[model samples]
Target: MAKLRPNLTDVDPVWNRIRKEAQDAMRNEPLIAGLVHSSLLHHATLERAMGYRISMKLASAEMSEQLLREICDEAFDSEPMLGQAVRADLAAIFERDPACHRLLQPVLYFKGFQAIESYRVGHWLWQQGRKDLAYFFQMRISEAFGVDIHPAAKIGRGIMIDHAHSIVIGETAVVGDNVSMLHSVTLGGTGKDDDDRHPKIADGVLIGAGAKVLGNIRVGHCSRVAAGSVVLSDVPPCKTVAGVPAKIVGEAGCDQPSLSMDQLLRATGE
Candidate 1:
């Protein structure tokens, strides 16, 4: 069973609580002291620690850890929004995931959070016109985390991906704020038409496991896409959709479907 740590109301409190958790972890298990020290205790701030952690995880034969760390540091330092997004992401996981006891879990153990942070650095690189470096980050993240999010994909803050295995977000995909999804979700395109392809998932949307949303369709805000559904068209705001070539089954049944994390498909009595 997972032991819950100290409560955190916001990003600042989260960092403080994570430090406390790290201290406890070191005292309890000395074997991982060095790991905890390097990953969590060494840095002065969450962004700095994240820079070190992601670089260490994604470093390859082509790119050394020191170089990767420098790049990540530069990204974190230059792009303030990256850190903001990261904080939001952490908060999203802590609040939404039942298994997550502390903010440290997402920083250290969650591949979804780590992958998204790495993708943020990649997106920064892309914005700076360093396409090759961005692509490199994309490759490393996919290889290490099994979550293939294109560097060009525009993802907003406070996103949570549960059991985030085999998740794919295409280049033209746009995921909005406070959105949540489970494993094996694909925001992909229908064909080779490269321009403006892939799905646009709006704020507070909840996408279920193994759901495939194809093409340049809009999934409106606060919507719910059921598990194993194949969505090829636009979904209206606050609606629940299901089945292959998914249809509107019912209302979202709540204001924020993502926050609720409810995948229940109440029969519409159609």
Candidate 2:
């Protein structure tokens, strides 16, 4: 069990709320009381809790839970930005996903959230030149969560990946801040290229389910990629694109399409 850090509540309202919710959860369902206690209440900070969760979810016969926990803890301790990203991601999920009712929900049950946090640890390893360990994290994350994100992929904070099944992000893919995407979305390369071959998704973009933005193209900020669209070119800011080889359909419909979680396509008159 992890020890609580002192003065955490004074500066971290998110952790405070999560702890409060964990206590409430224990009261609401006594069966999971032990789980809630170990996963949340035992920890001093959000980062420690996150490290435990990540290790628990990704641990296997090949890797011990204790070792994984140590790696995750080291990552969080070495990089303050990882903890910041965790808070941003939790907020993004709570704010964007209707199914997410509490900050604790994503931490305890959401595979998407778990997978992304695991990816963050893998990414930290990648940055530290621990490529083999990073690859191990990627493999375990994919097997455990069905979400395949290369450790080399650069994904920004405040990202919400709903469902998260069959999601693929290749090496060199750069996803900007506050981006939202549903299941089966792929940010991949067109074909045989070794350098910088994946798509670049800008900030506040909403990518609907089954959308594939391939090649080294840019999907500009605050844009919308309608479900099942196959985007092969660059998209301008605040535009909606849909179809096999997606073309501009209309405005993104809101300033922050990702946050709005809107997927409808309105006609010209409307």
Candidate 3:
């Protein structure tokens, strides 16, 4: 059994910042006060707020929001990493995305962030052998966010899925920490080789928009997959690949391609 990590005691500055922002928004826009209060101010911690937000977004006629909130709360309480990951993701978006100015945007507005958090709860349920509930989460997330991430897909911390539309991660896909990808990315299988047949993306990899990385291939650490590229083979570390069948076009250009969010090829590129 994995050890239950320590519960957060110190007041999270990120949560405080979010609350402050929410308070300001309430004053600035009187019309949205109700929405702001229910989503941000009503909850105490980031985890609780996230749970409520996700449950509210993904709830259906069949599943009540109250029940889903409990499930999400349980997941956040049991898995401290989920809370940590939320903070990391919030930070990642604020740091990497040029459009994101405040910490409140991802939590209250961004579908990508919400989808990933929902997937984390589903992933926790998957680990707990609640396959049915996990599948339900996958279904709702796909319907609500247009992102289909399998619950069994192992994604690490600090993930930023920009636009996040049409993002499909296979059941066996393993994405490492601090990875960033744009819209229409797929970490899918080559065919029906069900057993462990998905891409293993290393840390700090930047997968550009409309890129499809198929099969049980390894995208090495800090590599960049250029937009609209189809990668069928393994990518070496710190390299840039572009084309239908992606080739090492050049160096990754920066140490952290994901952090840089730089998709443009350098002048020296072949």
Candidate 4:
């Protein structure tokens, strides 16, 4: 087992908590001691650890782990907000997902969190006018994680993608902060237009599993989209929408539907 470091409360409480969890994990499961130490305790900061983790996951025969690690380190170092987003994403998973018992779980195991972090790095590359490199990151992330997010897509912080299988966010899509979506959700275009042709999901929205919000539409803030719904038009704020051609069935049932992670659709009267 890796020796526990001194309390890092004064430096970074979140990173400190994750390191503590990692040490406990190593003690509980000696089989993963090397994995935990190499992945967590080996780094001095969360950014360094994330760079190592993302590179390990995305590296392939086409790209060496060392090169990918360099790219990830550059992204994390060049942009401080990336680190902030990482912390917020960790908090989101821990607070919302029942399966997430510790902060270390998302860092060491969850594909959703890993995919999102990889997307953020690709987005940074895109913004730096390195489109081809960004595309490379996108391809590797999709191939590795089964989640496809265009590097040009504008996604805000504190986002949680549960299950994260077959998720497709188009280039023009804009996702707001604190939004949560389940597996197989697609923010895609209708294939008719060439520009600005994807969905704009507002803050605090809860999109259920297999939901498809197609076209250049807006899903308003604090709304709930029921499972398997096919939304083709704009949805108003604080409303619950369901059906193949989704409609406003009722209220969102709470102020922050994403935070609650509640998918049950109560009757309008009930």
Candidate 5:
């Protein structure tokens, strides 16, 4: 029941023709259904659709299906853990946010997911010597999503950014695995020096609300940056940092192994 926006609905006749024809042709196809049935693949297609609509709205025809396909393949391969984490986080966010209607409304309407996913594509495009094209696409996503993430920043897997309003990631910023950040988190620069001049967040780091992490600091693994902390320097592993220019305040989150399906199978010897 999800719709392609009203403004773009004018083209629905053409798109519907093509989509139905394709679906009809693939109705009995085995492999085609395999791809289409995957929840992850569907999520990706939806994101590409979002990117396309945003591009058209901005009057930029630069977003091609070929380019989007390249972005989707590359991004999907590059960040499996990140993608899983992001999806899981978004599901939880949807469950909690009373504003979301439990349907796919948030996915279609929420700019946060759309912008971030497109930025992943933008980053791929940038690395492939398409800087100008990448920038144009980024602008389109920004205009649509109200969220900005520079393509040059490095991010790891399973990054869940919920209600990600005003989130900014600097060019040199590096985020490690399983990092979750709430609204208004900034990984930014301090001065004019371009030499590794941004923050490096290690694995399993949870950045709280309105936290600003600046400079070339390293926030260690399994750490939590408390709400409203303006971090300026390095934080030790297994610790919590808080307050202005954030300093260590409490113990880190407990480290426990998350048992995988294979692990459970081995435990049961089935």
Candidate 6:
């Protein structure tokens, strides 16, 4: 458990600096504020990872490392795609959101940034066989942040948890790139098998507020899940779904946010 914690090497002062920088950056970015809230909950995810790791000691260290490598990559910032997606998200936010300004504000204040980043570190430690410590940090981050992500979940790049309050992503959930989810969205199970029970969100899908997607269903690319809807079955690409058990409601082609000149000019500050 102790092994899972950050090494805290005297030679490396970067972690503290990075944390401070992230905080300072998010102090003002409106888009990042939601992410910051989510990040505060990262500790829970880490704890989950640690618990999982404790069960992996029967295997050899090399085998344990191999089994957890993919999860670690998916969790930590060591994977370049994560950073790229984050940057792209910031760019898109800047292009469309008038209330945001300065990269620093978002980096520091966004719960998403902090939680995701903490997951990365916790994931690394979990992989190294220090499950208890990893879980400790993960739960701490989760308690601090409103966001809750399972360490075992496979999340892709360009994943956007927009306005992510009350959002719960479960274990065994697979989220693809360019997927956007609004507030109060839940990717959950249906009391089925513990393995691979959550839904899979494909690329370029937009999920509206308060939507619940359950079971092992797949939400296809370019699909739109309307607000307050509950998805149960698999949705095809380019479709829009709504209702209790979400059904195809309309076509979802190029449905994106747009920013006007006045809106863009309203909040451009340092």
Q: Give the candidate number with the greatest lDDT.
A: 2
Maximum-TM-score candidate? 2
* Residue pairs that clash (backbone atoms under 3 angstroms), model 5: 81-158, 82-157, 82-158
Per-prediction TM-score, please? 0.94, 0.97, 0.96, 0.96, 0.64, 0.62
Report lDDT (CA) for all predictions: 0.92, 0.95, 0.94, 0.95, 0.62, 0.58
User: Where does candidate 5 stray beyond 4 Å?
Assistant: 1-106, 256-270
The order by descending lDDT is: 2, 4, 3, 1, 5, 6
Cand. 3 Cα-lDDT: 0.94
- Per-residue CA lDDT of model 1 for 69-157, tens digit only, reads 98998887787788789989999999999999878998988999999999999999999999999999999999999999999999999
C-alpha RMSD of each candidate structure in angstroms = 5.8, 2.2, 2.3, 4.1, 11.8, 11.3
After superposing all C-alphas onto the true structure, candidate 6 shows an RMSD in angstroms of: 11.3
lDDT of 3 by residue, 172-217 (tens): 9999999999999999997766699999999999999999999999
Instruction: Encode model 5's per-residue lDDT on 1-270: one tens digit a residue.
Output: 223323422443423433443355357665665433332223324334444433333343655655555555555555443345445534544544456543243444556655666676677677768788777766766676656777888776555566788888888999986676778999999989988899999977778779999999999887777879999999888677788967776665455111010111111112
For residue 266, give model 1's deviation from the true position in Å. Answer: 1.0
Q: By TM-score, is 5 or 6 better?
A: 5
Summarize candidate 4's per-residue lDDT along 1-270 as a digit string, tens digits. 223344444699999999999999999999999999999999988988999999999998899999999898888878889989999999999999999999999999999999999999999999999999999999999999999999999999999999999999999999999999999999999977789999999999999999999999999999999999999999999999999999999999999999999999998887
Superposition error at 123 for model 2 (Å): 0.3
Q: For candidate 1, give the lDDT of residue 74.
A: 89
- Give stretches of model 3 more than 4 Å off: 1-10
lDDT of 4 at 170: 98
